[model samples]
Target: MSTDHGDRPVTGVRLQKVLAGAGVASRRVIEQYIVEGRIRVNGAVVTELGTRIDPEHDLVDVDGTAVQLDAGKRYVMLNKPTGVVSSMKDERGRPDLRRFTREWPERLYNVGRLDADTSGLLLLTNDGDLAHVLAHPSFGVTKVYIAKVDGRVSPQTIAALTRGITLEDGPIAADKARLRDSSHGSSLVELTLHSGRNRIVRRMMAAVGHPVTELVRRQFGPLRLGTLPSGHARELGKIELGALLTLARRDSPAEATPGEAREKTRDHGQHDDQENG
Candidate 1:
């Protein structure tokens, strides 16, 4: 059992942490549902964020749906191709990420998401704790994206992106933004940011008058796309997994809030950038 700073025993995982791995919802959204009295354990409605129950012994359900946690936790990386969604299902019969993991029986959820048009690295895992920690805004995990946008993205655009821009939701800033290459008609610019807002990269670029033609996520924290072929996936090796865990452990989420935590936790690929504005 882990002990908190106040010497309280932290037994089992937190309720939100456990439920997020079930792939029914993200941790932030689960917390909202819990506060709304939508989650129950052992027939009792539980709205406690710190409530911990044994996954092996407790009867956990969300809105009457029993939560089944995967026994074997797996960490994987997929080079998602264009036109493939980051979700497990799509109502319009669009291609989803499930096609790449059909061989694996365990239901693996995407750690985050890349929009249908964005092609690049995506993490898939069954470890709910890690997923919650990594996606939490307090950790500020950086994602690197390469965007091919219309026009030679001007110096003004780079400055605006690097400094910050105001979106309909709020003001957001990129950690870094610079021109990787420039041509007569288009430019390839690289953007690094920790924001998880829907269509953030696309919106930022579009706001600067350079609508993105193609976008690809090359890296997320310590994980990178490398030379992986599109639509293929492989288990993360020891080193990469260790690096990710180390980063997650850097902060214990002492100051995470529901509103701030919603930044990237719930928005992954849910909104199309083409329609963001």
Candidate 2:
């Protein structure tokens, strides 16, 4: 199947595939609906497993309701505020990240999570592939946090954090750890880690005898929190998005050289302050 695109043949994708790509549901689940005689192609019931669909031309329906492939998936970063859950729908009926994005057309989900009390950079996206890449530990997407702890942290404590710490979930370590400020028996420390374990930052501080009083994520991978007002969101620009895709592709042996990688990192750092200052 193909669609005419200014004399170019753009291969047409199936309705079920398009729906899955839109983060609606898995192909298997969509197929189940088809088998139940709930799906139609161009107004005709399509129970055949191999039914092909041209999304641009065909009218597809599920359960007698029309289904159109959502155009242009949305990728947004939210500066989640305190007291708001980082969930799509909260069972407790409390405010959630969705409140900040209720007007958006595309459905979005948090890339990872942030505790209700921990406010900072939180990613919301309808792009499932990018979400998977950002959340997956294998990609080593670094998350940086600025934490205010109850007690002073010495060089030894910072060293311990950098070296490694043991927790019930298992051993964990920060890629970088340093004291940012020390005053009035309380200290602010910056921590960078690739692990997405729940409450890992607070737990790590507790393990080091300095329970955290406040926590705020400052950065996520190449994306930074910057001066985005609490509860506001902004779309990821093309350059940043490209950098992330390049980073993901770097896993392959044929990827860019280390020098190129460093240059990209340096460029990202230069703009970090502007984006999140």
Best by TM-score: 1
Q: Which runs in model 1 stand beyond 4 Å of their true positions?
A: 1-71, 252-277
Give the per-residue Cα lDDT of candidate 2 at 11: 58
Per-candidate RMSD, Å: 12.2, 15.5
Candidate 2 lDDT tens digits, 1-277: 3323465545567656876775557999987876788876765787756556676556565655444354665668789888887677767898877687777887777777787888999877765545555554455578899999998899999999999989998999999999999999999999998876768898999999999888899898778988899889988775555455455544423333334433433122122221110
Instruction: Report residue 254 deviation for candidate 2 (angstroms).
Output: 16
Looking at model 1, report the run of 10 residues with the lowest lDDT sum.
Answer: 268-277
* Model 2 weakest lDDT span, ten residues long: 268-277
lDDT of 1 at 118: 85
Compute the lDDT of residue 81 as modeled in candidate 1.
91
TM-score versus the correct structure, for each prediction: 0.66, 0.65
